[model samples]
Target chain A: MAAAAERRPVWMRAMIYGFVATWFILAAFPFIWTVWGSFKVELDFFSIADWTYALTGERTKAEYGSAFTDAGYRGAWIQEEFYRNFFNTAIVCFFVVCTSLTIGTLGGYALSRSSYNYTFWLLITALIFRAMPPVTLVAGYLLPFFQWNLWGHLATTIIVLVAINQPFTLWMLHSFFKKIPQELDESAKVDGCTQFQAFRHVIIPVMWPGVITTGLFSFLLAYNDFVVTSMLLEEKNRTMVPQIAAFLGTTYTEGNVMFAVAAVVSATVPLFILVMFFQRQIVSGLTAGAVKG
Target chain B: MKHRTFFWFFLPTAIAMLLFIAAPIVSVLIQSVFAPHEAVLIEVENCTPLVGCTTETMIDQEATRDLREAQPLGRFVGLDIYLDRAHLAIEEVGQIWSTSETWGSFWSRIFNLPFYRAMSFTLTYTFVVTPALIVLGLMIALAVNSLHRHLKGLMIFFSLLPMIVTPIIGSLILFWMVDSRGVLGSALVSLAGDPNFSLKASTGLTWVMLIIYGIWSSAPFAFVVFYAGLQTLPRDTLEAAQIDGATRWQQVRYVIIPHLTPLVTFVALIQLMDNFRVLEPIIGFNASAHATSLSWIILNDLGGETRQLSSASANSVLTLIGVAILLSPVLVRTWQDFKRKT
Candidate 1:
């Protein structure tokens, strides 16, 4: 009976490993396949003759006389002026991170430190907004932005995104600030530092981990946004994700899906690097919200 | 930490939330009640030799333009938009209920209406994906927790890819592979032994594909949270069960599961909120033909040249209501927890 039970777990362990490996492959394969398939000509990638054309680049060789091609990248980056959209996206993400974090740090610090009734309501107010879809707010921003002549610029998008991102950032950073022993900052204040000075001096040093995690989420929000960015920004001022979306709208008729494929791969590379560098922080940040925030 | 000092620190975010976040919800509420002004029309009397004293219905272009400029908010239509066929479709629902011969047909006919169609899919996606992801996440957490420490990190690194990729891009990657000419699609074609078989042509297949995508993308979030919870599981309880000669399954059922229940609730709550806003996949797959989500319907109104703000606002208000209804339990629970803690 012991031997039989032992035999059962041997396969059970194998089953567990098998399931884990299969899920990992499912999670990672689409990105790898798309990145590889982006390099081939359309015919080979979507070959009706055989799927092996995708792997061996049969039609890619027939067309470009090589197994690989940069035609899609060139088409997307240069001819499509995806570079301009990339620049716009970079500007938007950078400013959104900086602005949200600046205001979020101060506000989050206050929320964490306060022993007031209003803090609960304020956090609850933010919780409601954070739960809301961003597009719903885009509707309200439209008429005002148009009236004020502030609709399409990178600045307007930045300000709007910062507002949209602030609540979550504030909530995340507040929890982070609460983790530090209250005595550290209180001592700084008692030693003649003002509250701001305590924040600037004592709290700032130990707050990097939480702030970094919060800022990563902020970056993701601004970088990956589609509905607001696409809706608010005009044709000339669109960001990368919206531009990729635009490519789909027009290029499906023109059969330039490769341009979109390349643009998508380019956009994902930064996130890939971000995840690789900060896996632990990202995991912790995600669980942090579930636990408390 | 003083009130005066805290006031200054909190003012900027306070202003932002009040202006953008809080104000928009109010704006959507107001916009839903009031419709945009109808295009004004005016008549002009024309006397010409050919027709001889005819009263022509020519537009008073200047006056019409003036009226629109003067009252941009439009006439208040009250709840007409909310109750209309485009929205709540109350009349249609009643008619379908009275007319349809069979139960299946009745539900299908009601689902044909745009609002009901979107709501049906949204609720289904939320209800389906939340539990599915939770179970899958727990299993993966259990499996990964039993692994060697070095392998655990690598497995996690690989696992985070699906969740971290942008929704549109991630869906597009999967969409491409499932395109009829791509590998998976073509493989299915061969498997069916029918060259004409395509998922795009079938509603059931398209929905199944979307649900798979939803599960694929969100399960990692659940796994990561549950795995973290698993690390803190009391070893003493497990050893106690072992000394009692309990089977491994019983130990898991009794101790491990109980320990992970709160994390399970956390993951479920988050997934419910996230999956309800399933807009990007429909756009990426171009599968709106087969499936329409509530968020997608709002996007449809907002996207094109028409910019039907009134209809979109009504849908927004309704979707907000749906979310509130779904979220009220969590809110009440949190409020109770706060009361108890204080």
Candidate 2:
């Protein structure tokens, strides 16, 4: 009877494991497929079965040469307009990340070391900014950016992207900064440190995790951004995602393999690197920064 | 708490923010009314007591010449665009209300059936997806919370991997998996005895796939939030429920539900905000798949040569208004809930 009872619980545990495993499979299957698909040759991918098969097979020399070499480069260059678009997106993300992170960290520090009302106001303001949709200003505001040359510059796109993403970065780092005790700031100030000095030396060291989390998010956002990038970037200055779309049109018949290859390479790799690098802080960062931001 | 210290601490951020973040947003608001032709202008004065002062504004005379150059050089149209768009919007409403067309007619063809249809569909998608995410997230949290320590950490990380993966990649995976010969399709056909398991074409199947894909991609983050909230929950109340002879359902209903409400509200509110901005899945899926989202509409409107900047902007502004309408209540309620907690 005792053995039978024990078997029931063990069986239940196995069922739970199975259920959880299924969920993970559903969540993870695409990433796994994309990684493999990235490496697949043009012909093999056309009628590819079980997306994961791309992972196990070696790419033919021609396929390998095309994906990495000038053949692939020339094909993608004309087909997708990728060479130009990649730079557009990289420039946008670079400036957006740098501007937003700098502003957010400074603002986050103020909110942390400051009074309750400041924190409250900052939180509310950031929340409102967080909730504010990009589509809202797309016409009434951003239209002028395209209409006027000043607003059409690469700088304008960066400025807008930075503004749009700042609230979340600020909110994320604010919460993280708040978690650090005030005692450290007080002692640093007591050690003849100016407020900026204390912030630069002591607070920054302790808040590296928070800074990293915010930076990673800012980077991902700028990297993965589509709407504003699509809207603001002109024909000459199309971004990476748009470049990928342009690839689809250019490579309509035989280009799927190239697109699949580029799509796999450009879209998935940075994200994988991000998760791998910030594996520990990423979960907390996203939950705290992104969802809440 | 000293006023001086507050000023000093807040001033740097306030200044930087005012210049960068706040200035641009304010400028947007200002331009929403003023509709400025130029972004900013700088004037240089080299006074030689003789005759010399020159002003250079960053205005691109060449670009503005075609549109509104007839007006005073530096003057704005002053809400003419807003008023025009508003009129256009009302006409759009009247047409949609009165039309018998499958997609609704637009008073101005610019605000046609497809536009409104896409808007409604996007809203419905958000409405459906957000609550499902909240409830499913809570379930995952409860399940994860029930796990032993080491297993719990591993499980959380596993769940989170999806959240870490880009949504574009996530959608692509779904695209492949539901392709007729993919593993998921084969599994479905074998189980249900229907060989033609079409995830792309059929509406019911498409929605099911979208929701499942959305939940799968998003629930990890939600789970983390709910799990964090669960950790912070006071234990004594749950223990007391057990002591009072509460059944499992009763303990959860009476105790856990109340405690979890704030997290639920936060999750739902954030989901409401983010999901409306969703552009990736539709973009990745492409139009051949019959996926029409509001973001896609805005993207397409601005993407082409007809280049209807005003209409596209109006469309985005409308989406913003819609989001504000749906979300402000949630924000206020969440704020109140948080205040109560503090």
Using lDDT, give the best candidate's number: 1
Clashing pairs in 2: A139-B313
Clashing pairs in 1: none
Give me the displacement of residue A13 in model 1, in angstroms: 1.1
> What lDDT tens digits, residue by residue, belong to model 2 across residues B1-342?
345655665565456445545554554454444443453344555566668776655655555664455542234565455445332355556555677365423333443456655665577678888888877777777766666677777777667767766666566666665665554565565677876656676765665666666777778878888787777677788778867888766976888888877667777777888888766777665532454666666666656665555445545555657767877786687689778968
Q: Which stretches of model 2 miss by more than 4 angstroms?
A: A1-11, A41-95, A116-119, A140-155, A187-193, A234-239, A287-293, B1-67, B70-112, B146-154, B180-198, B202-205, B233-247, B287-291, B334-342
C-alpha RMSD of each candidate structure in angstroms: 2.3, 9.4
- lDDT per residue (tens digit) for residues A1-293 in model 2: 12422434666657656766676666666666655554555544433344333444434444554332333444555665566776776787778777777777877777777766557866777677677666545543454454466455678777777777867877888788878998898898898988878888988788877788788888887877666666666668777765665555556576454554455456656676666667667767756743333
CA lDDT scores, all candidates in order: 0.88, 0.64
DockQ, per model, reads: 0.58, 0.28
Q: DockQ score of candidate 2?
A: 0.28
By TM-score, the best candidate is 1
